[model samples]
Target chain A: MKPVEIIDIDVSYGAKKILEAITFHADAGEILGIIGPNGSGKTTLLKAMSRVVARDSGEIRLDSRNLDTLGYRELARQVAVVPQDISIGFDYTVRDIVMMGRHPYIGRLASETLRDVEICDHAMHLTNVAHLTGMSIHDISGGERQRVLIARALAQEPKILLLDEATSNLDVSHQVEILNIIRDLTGKITVVSVFHDLNLAAYYCDRLLLLKDRKVYATGTPEEVLTYENIREIFQMETLVKPHPLTGRPYILPVYTHQSGVGTNRRVHVVCGGGTGSDILQLLHAAGFTVTCGILNVLDTDYGTAMHLGLPCVAEPPFHGITPESLSGLRECLDDADAIVVTAMPIGRGNLDNLRVLLDYRTKPIILYSRNSNSPMEDYTGGEAAAVLADLETRGALRVEEAEELLARLSQGYSGRS
Target chain B: MRRTAFITIPALACTLLVSVACAAALGPTGISPGSLLSLPNAWTIIWDVRLPRVIAAALVGCALAVAGTAMQGLFRNPMADPHIIGTSSGGALGATIAIVLFAGAGRPVFAFAGAMAATFAVYFISRKRGKIPVETLLLSGIALSTLLAALLSFLMYTAGRSLHQIMFWLMGGLWNVSWDDVIVALPILVGCAGIYLFARDVNILSLSEEDATHLGVNVEGLKRILLVLSALVAGIAVAVAGSIGFIGLITPHVMRLIVGPDHRLLFPAAALAGAILLVWSDTLTRTFTNDMPVGIITACFGAPFFIYLLRSRMKT
Candidate 1:
């Protein structure tokens, strides 16, 4: 069952509507991450849930009860918020700040009981801020202060905790540390945090809500919501989406947009294997060339890089020699290419067809990148592959020693394709 | 820190006792130590004249300092005081109106009403949506205070025969205050007790309004209650002793530095420190010169300290 449900909420500041018809529900014992661009009402949504800002029209239900009917103290007992920036201008001890979270549980004239003190102490220990209990908050580091604020929220013993960019100011290690703490609290407490880091949200949150235009653009698990198209539409930036090798969660790599040189429209087919063509393919694709790779085994690292870059490829099954049908598919790719570039890859019996396909396209403008001068050592084909490479060079194939030299030659040879 | 508290509370209590005794003993007609053997004359002077004034000073000091502490906590700014948001000027305006027109038993009532009006005006003006941004509230308070001060000067200029009385009230002295004036201080005592009950809430408020709300504090309601109570205490203090300066502004700050920001300890400490400060300052005014206003002495001490606070805050 959902612990909290917000239905058709609308919030306005004066005449300006900050949020419109926003609806979502946070299940019990799950972390719901809110992700959006700035001014998309991410923080405003969190504030509305915490009742810091009153929603103009909507009903918020906590534990199946209408929120407006609950007293502030009762609501506070259930929900606690750790704000983005907590400025400790005065000298308040860490213990004193944490003890403030017990305000809802204590009576007006009564002080904190022994049990209350133990809860605060346990919260400090959970956040790793117990050692700084007696120290002034003003004297702590920023990361330590963030932890102390989280600890303060935890001391509320709240069933639901709301964090608004709580870890934005921390370094990577601290961010992971704090998020790990929140992640571990999932089974006992519900957490709804606004995250600026997409990767961190993907890693830590159980489900994600992407907001756009003051509404929920998408909501699902991280693998379902953090898609390249959704991110491109919302954030208006091109990104590469790949799965994390260890966790299988979606990871985002931002494509840099500051390329200066004019890119040509020429198509280049790279014939290489054993990870040699990875850098060449990346460079050519970044230079705005249509790149394709061919006759590569499916499990090869170069094929993996190609799949990650979304380039079309002709491939065979893992550890299988190139068949006649695959060689025909490579010829079709070579036919569509304006130029061909081959990297310094070892020639082997299992992939001898790759070198033979290159010989067939010898008349075309082909650049052979032989970084290793001793080609005989890589000839697992017993001088047959070496003899074929020597014949290709004699048939007017361009010999380049480095990737940069290969790029310089390609750009020079294909200038008119622009 | 607990050790400091153990020694400091008793030491402060002793100093307050000694100050009260010394202030009662030294006056225009100095009671000689040997003359204390004659109980009749000494008792008459102590009870009739010096005792009332000393008691009045202590009450006014305690009221103003506690009100100032509440104001500072409400605004979450150390520089905030009773007068920063025009509450004192509002009370002064009310008192001036009473003296100029009614000239009777309606002074405290009118003053309390005026202070509440000013507080509500600033509170409403500074509010946006549901939250009151501290910076906007501070700026609005300053703007309204300047406006109120102008209106007060105009009223003073127009009062022909009551001009001296108006100036004396505005200057804030403790002369000729009988037990009748001390009766106005009763509300201040009640208000201080009421504020102490919410001392924990006030401490949470010092963090931020939203933070306090998350901790189950009704921030808007708490602000309203504290603002009204502070204005009441400050208004009564002004009504009884005129508009004494600096005791409210400096005493709470000194106490906070010594006792930390825990309102539970800071409030009582500030009350004691304020009572002692005003009693001594009033004594100095009476002893060093004849019938000089105590307001001048407090301002003389308060103005430089205010500047020093500003400079130190800037450096930080």
Candidate 2:
């Protein structure tokens, strides 16, 4: 059993103080999750525990030994730290890199022993990177590289493992795969990981430490530390907490904005593609207009941007063609709207029904661009579409040249153009 | 891997042998390659004249490449060139003072002294604000190199009759290399390589000073050893080969691209590659037309590749 303790430790990079008077302790055979926003000193605290980052004032102790007093090899044997940014920038093969973890175990004149090879091989197999042992590090995908890094640490055979935001760049499935591995290793090895995802921490970590403004805000079991009030205070985001369906741990649903002052009047449905609604949604929301978007995919950079902007955007899985269910969802969002604005995102086969829906909503003012007809969907521009759009333009539908013009026209406090 | 290693080792050996043969065959009066192998005077000339020059070139090449590779690893930057930290110019200034002011008396000793002094100065300056900032290393290197280059030029302008000899030395020629020059330069080169070869302890040192110390590496001591070794090798090399360029910078870089950035592999690969590249460069300088300074041939080929790499990195 290993005991890790941080006693009022403070850390600073140059003049900028990153962590302040942080005190915590982890019992043997426990998993500790540190959760915070970007640049919030979560990684810094882990580094300090691993003795990778020097603490300015307080002492970090491991198994009753002062951290600073231990030699590198001694520390390497006890605490294996997977750094937040593991950049294998060269052409070393996966196996070769994993063997670097054995650096502390071998003597100067001696080659790697059979036991070292066995440890590394076991780590590779456990991490599921044995198939990629011969591949150069530069040639592997980011997810595969993350596994290799974890394998390297495992090869060290440390009693305590420190991972700093180790799964941030991975996809959801890979993230779950890594978290499960960390979970399975918990009783065998003490695990500490800096995490940004509260749900993941709640799922895997027995205890959670929340950092705020470079100080430890709270620390306890996941249910205690990951509450709505604590998360609202630490992350500066209001959230609704409920039991997770599977694990029954507290799951947080973000409460974006209070609707009291913001108008619920003049609700508008947006047909957004290629990130076009980002500005329009923001501008409309600022003008007290309620807006919802559809025909966007989750993996698009735009979806994240829209989520950041707190828009109720309907998203499909990436590369999956827009289904009838999504089209129906878009129609339902449009049914309540007084008007619609079509931003000049490229239209294609996946989203031609959005433009067709616009044609059916003849009373709604349709704004098209001159250069916007270059969509990949022929239905959007070919056939009798040109003449139909021309008739619509002459009758009531308007055409705008710029995004700013579209926003200004939409937010004139009323839908009078139609 | 064994095949590559065998092929490379023999190729280096063959190149060294051929360079010695060619340099021996051509002199004040031409001696053919076959005739030199047979005659006793030609054999002595070969040993006394061409052998030392060839050995000097190979040793200096290995030394400069090892130093350059170590510096690049320390910096974690691929674009780092030899003399980016001003060691070469400092060594040049030292050699110039020894040649022009001291009149080639105690030249190698004084050059080594100047080189060490310049290195310490650069180190102290880089470490001043408690961190060895990469920008500080690069900028200060440029500043010191320019300053030393100006001082060297001043020494050149004031050297009344010895200006021509100093200029030729500065331009890097192996024409006048002798057994004594070989004896003086080879030990320093070999010693530096040996010390660097024992630098597995330093392999764990981070690209940054702070990280290295935290990793339990004696950062100050390692930096001092590295800078001193680089200067010793460079000072001896400049003392022998004048200011031969590119082998120090290019050989290390090419080696890094082939073997990973791990210093254990990088250092030795650089030394071997440098030995091969310079021996061939000297051979080219000998056979291409006139017995030109090997520096001219290296820079002509290496500069374009360097520029192309820089542009490509920028594009990426």
Candidate 3:
């Protein structure tokens, strides 16, 4: 199959040009993701590609045929679109809704044949929504409804599928699950989707099309397109680009700095648990300390909250416990630190060794706060765990009453606080 | 959320049947229910006079509702009515001209002519080069209706002694309905039903013009057919009964609230509901007082309901 080419397309609504001089080609079987901020004409571009929006002067071609020459039925046979908003107030069953996709194939007064029903069944099964066949489209869940829409598009059996923010309202698992299905469809069908989640786009799309000011800002593989400089230029955000450990995809981490007379003076490092280290990270910043957090996985709420607050955090893959690499990364952070705060966290088999990293650094005073029974890190002081805790206690790590007491001691020039 | 379609259909049918029976029962001279069936002439009179009028009422009701539903979908607007596309004004203008120019001639033919003309005019004015601006279609229809209303008023003024007859026609009534009028309207109503059988396609058109076009519907052709069919029904209804108010505009809206937006069910249900509503309204006018017109009765009920809908929509 030949590539879909958009050549020097310019689209304007009234006097304002929404898209300006766009040129590109999307090959068959390529999963291309378009990313841009609001009002950047991502939707307008999609509309142009579908030949729904009139361009000022340009040509869009599919398999060497100018899109303008192709009839609507012919276009429908090749491209099926799943819009972001499906405003259906009609009383159509899920099956009926999906069957509407076969409209281009069915005769005007003809009913669906056995083959049409089979195709619809296959589409529903692929979307895992056959159970909703008898249900009204309005009566289903948003996630389920979204899947049904996908199923409807799939039933069209098009060579190219266009999805505009398909996973916007879905939950985390649903988002990942839907994107996986879309990814798996890449080799069989050309896919173009608009995504707001940068990480998701990085993980799924073979190539990223970043639109800036109605122009194609950059287009390449995730690694080339997701660089820190390009993101700062296109998205207008200052962030750090780091590589994922497993997939090695580039992930973004934002940095936020506060200006204070105190911050200019000192710097502190925290080894904390259950995200209790957040306050110390904040206070240290308010008091002019350069702080960094580490070893927390991507799913940890504290890690997310930290990122939202614009802290420089080093997070690991979340599991039942921390890995050796996480322990080493935490130790490296501890070594570079002027002071260390070891907050009371549940000593599980995964992270018991995390606390043990404080053992190697003997010179720095380690502030150990008593674990409240209600605290998450309170459980599982085992044979090895007990020995580790005893050894730390014997080493004269300051046993503190509360986080505030530790802060007070730090203010008095002792060492650090958790 | 759960709907009982079977029960709803029968309940509406029963109401329509009862309303028709009552209308026949309460004429200038009170006719006995038993006597109605006994006399063969009485049966002919009821079927010919009362039944045609009732069927006309029902068919007109359905036509207006279906047209209204189609217009709403075509414009992707909620408050749109069947007549908003200048069909009624055009039809009325056509009927008015035929009454003035070819008085006592076949009024239905002229009325249909004027209606089709007005529909085409509105269609052209709204179309720029080749593209139909949905917003422009609405604004142009409003402008045309206002212009035609002014012309209609001028014609009424020059009509002089004929004004009384013209005024009655303007206000609308089914008093003079006969088998001939039914004969005239049957084909139009049948045509409307045939057009409405394509209601499933109209559902797709309601989403977006682009979506409709891409889905293999001839968007422009479908629009033209729907508009012409709606005008025919409206024109024939007006010619048979004269400017009957509210049934065309109100019935479809009420049906939508119950049945949702699927036009397949909505069109037929609205037709039945409109038929029932108008029949009962006509019955009330004939039984309670001979002084008022059927249009007046419909307006009396429709205006407040329309206001209520507008107010509620605003709150949402």
Q: Candidate 1, residues A1-418: lDDT per residue as tens digits? A: 5799999999997788888998899999999999999999999999989888889999898889888898888988899898777886679999999998889999997989999999999999999999999999999998888888889899999999999999998899989998998888889999999999999999999999999988889999999999988988999886768799899999998876444343477789998888888777777888878889977989887897788678899999987888889888888999998888877787799888877877776457877776666652367888888888788777777778776777777877642221
What would the TM-scores of all predictions be? 0.93, 0.73, 0.72
Predictions' DockQ, in order = 0.76, 0.10, 0.27
How high is the TM-score of chain A in each model? 0.90, 0.63, 0.67
lDDT for each residue of candidate 2 in B150-203, tens digit (9 for 90 to 100): 888888887764655555555677778888888888766565656565455445
Q: Considering just chain B, what TM-score does every model have? A: 0.91, 0.84, 0.86
lDDT accuracy of residue A360 in candidate 2: 70
Question: Which residue runs of candidate 2 sit more than 4 Å off their true CA positions?
Answer: A258-418, B1-3, B26-40, B100-106, B116-143, B195-224, B256-266, B283-291
Give the range of the ten consecutive residues with the poorest summed lDDT in model 2 chain A.
A369-378
Q: What does the lDDT come to for candidate 1? A: 0.84
After TM-score superposition, the amount by which residue B224's alpha carbon in candidate 3 deviates from its true location, in angstroms, is 4.0
What order do you get sorting by lDDT, best first? 1, 3, 2
Q: Score each candidate by Cα lDDT.
A: 0.84, 0.72, 0.74
Regions of candidate 1 where Cα sits further than 4 Å from its true position = A259-261, A298-301, A304-308, A317-325, A370-383, A399-404, A414-418, B33-41, B123-143
